[model samples]
Target: METNLTYEAAYKELTEIAQEIENESVSVDVLADKVKRASELIEFCQTKLRATETEVNKIIKQMENQ
Candidate 1:
């Protein structure tokens, strides 16, 4: 997993992977690999979202204080 992956990109990939899994388009041989990649993307997206939320909250608090 590259640290440079943007939240939107990771999210898009995750959605695509989920669709493939749901639609049974992924072959059984590569299912494990897809699952692993999806897990990584999910983690990346979650971390990015948490960081963004923290930053947004900090800015909001600062605005309120001022």
Candidate 2:
């Protein structure tokens, strides 16, 4: 897992993983690892999206209040 992974990078990796799995390119041994990494990327992407959304909303509220 990458400690300093950006949202775009995580999303790109997730997409690639999905494609690989869909294509059945990953062997059984490595499939589990790929799935696990995809899970982590999903979690990271979700958290980043939520935090960005909250920040955007807060900024909007502040602007409205001004």
Candidate 3:
């Protein structure tokens, strides 16, 4: 199984890829690779966000039960 990437790391990677894509120096041919990487990073970020939301909900439920 793959280790979970920290939100910070994933966000940083996403930002870097966006910046690269924004740069005019980047060749059109490489855009496809960058897009693929960006998609994967997005999925990773979404999974992390969902996990966090579930944890927060659990905490809230526990507090309400007290």
The top-ranked prediction according to TM-score is 2
Candidate 2: C-alpha lDDT: 0.96
The candidate, 2 or 3, that scores higher on TM-score is 2
Residue 57, candidate 2: Cα error in Å is: 0.4
Q: How well is each residue in 1-66 modelled by candidate 2, as lDDT tens digits?
A: 678899999999999999999999999999999999999999999999999999999999999999
What's model 1's overall lDDT?
Answer: 0.94
RMSD of each: 0.7, 0.7, 1.8
**Shift in Å, residue 5, candidate 1:** 0.8
**TM-scores for candidates 1 onward, in order:** 0.94, 0.96, 0.85
Ranked by TM-score, top first: 2, 1, 3
lDDT of 1 at 5: 80
Q: Highest lDDT among the candidates is held by which one?
A: 2
lDDT of model 2 at position 19: 99
lDDT by residue (tens digit), candidate 1, 1-66 = 885888888999999999999999999999999999998998888888999999999999999999
Clashing pairs in 3: none
Model 1 stretches with alpha carbons more than 4 Å out = none
